[model samples]
Target: MAWLLLIVGGMFEVGFTTALRFVDNFRNLPWTLAFFGSVTISMGLLEYAARSIPMGTAYAVWGGIGAVGTVLVGMIFFDEPSTLIRVLLILTIVAAIAGLKLFA
Candidate 1:
């Protein structure tokens, strides 16, 4: 269940981060609301995940997942770079997240 929460938090993190550009420096009310809502949910779920998971492991996994997810979301939706280097970096983050899960 903690892993589930972590994934949920990651999803929310991706949402908020990707929405950041659309928010237009907080001038766009709808996007601003979405950004704030997603980030709030993400933090709440991260706090819940920390209750059962070790702090270092949970934090690393959460950050790694969010980072990778956000980049993928950006590439897919925002027409950001999808270079081979970026893919390799994302793969490394995935491996690190898996290693942390296994060792945790």
Candidate 2:
């Protein structure tokens, strides 16, 4: 359950981060609200996950998900760079997150 929450939090992290781009330095009210709401949810879930998971492991996984998800979202929706190297880096993050879960 905690792991589930952590993953959800990670997804929310992506939401907030992507919304950050739309917020345009926070001049857009709708985007700013989205960003803040997503971030708030993500933090709340992370706090729940911390009850059962080590902070370091949970944080690493959370960050990994956010990073990979944000990159994919940017590539797919925002026309951000998605070079092979960047894709590989995202893959690496996935593998590391999996490794941490397996070894933890």
Candidate 1 — which pairs collide?
Answer: none
Task: Give candidate 2's TM-score.
Answer: 0.94
Model 1 misses residue 46 by how many Å?
Answer: 0.4
For candidate 1, the clash count comes to 0
Over all chains combined, what TM-score does candidate 1 have? 0.94
Query: lDDT of each model, Cα atoms only?
Result: 0.90, 0.94
RMSD of 2: 1.0
lDDT of 2: 0.94
Off by over 4 Å in 1: none
